[model samples]
Target: MARTSNMLKAAMALVLCYPLAIAESEDDFWEYDVRVSEGYCVYRNKTFAAYVDYTLEEPCEKWNCYPDDQMVLEQHCPPPPGYEIPSNASKDAWPYCCSNSTSS
Candidate 1:
């Protein structure tokens, strides 16, 4: 009967669409608790290497003039001479220094 044929077609359509729906659900993946701190860093091996220098020395002073001598954590890499600096260096917006408190 046509009713049986329609029901079969409907089930076939749903079976075909089920995989596409499952594929879309995978796109919602996300990472949580990604805490980033502002600090100087260098890029090595396709990853950012972080360093914190609180000396308030010459090069850092040029970037920001603050008397507090706060921890200067910037993201920079020392490439070879004449090598172009990467424009996509990571710079954390929230600047935080290493604290004596271990809770960080």
Candidate 2:
């Protein structure tokens, strides 16, 4: 009886931890770098004017530059639950082709 109880506890713990694991994995996919000097933001050896919004195609991220020499980063997260990607979808396209529709 104790063995069965322990096994149930173990299963309950795993179920509770599953969402945390998913959240961590999603957070790990993003990369951030911010450098501000002379009222501008520098990224990848390039300088961006203040109050400008720019995008990076390689990783499909959007960056917003603020006059205070601060930058905000936003990227496409994983598709919603139950969404399905077509077989011929292009991974290089990122958010655009990452997912299509829910499995039916």
Question: Can you give the lDDT of residue 4 in candidate 2?
Answer: 60
Output the lDDT of residue 89, model 2: 48
Clashing residue pairs for model 1: 39-73, 39-74, 40-73, 40-74
Q: Report how far residue 99 has shifted in candidate 1, in Å.
A: 38
Largest TM-score belongs to which candidate?
Answer: 2
Candidate 1 versus truth, CA RMSD in Å, comes to 22.4
Quote the lDDT for 53 in model 2: 37
lDDT of 1 by residue, 21-91 (tens): 22323222111122233432222111222322222122211111111222122312221123232354223
lDDT of each: 0.26, 0.46
Q: What TM-score does candidate 2 get on C-alpha atoms?
A: 0.37
TM-score of predicted model 1? 0.19
Per-residue alpha-carbon lDDT of candidate 2 for residues 5-93, written as tens digits (9 for 90 to 100): 64455335433533332343454233344687897777667677754335444555434444342443333544334334446545554
**Which residue pairs show collisions in model 2?**
none
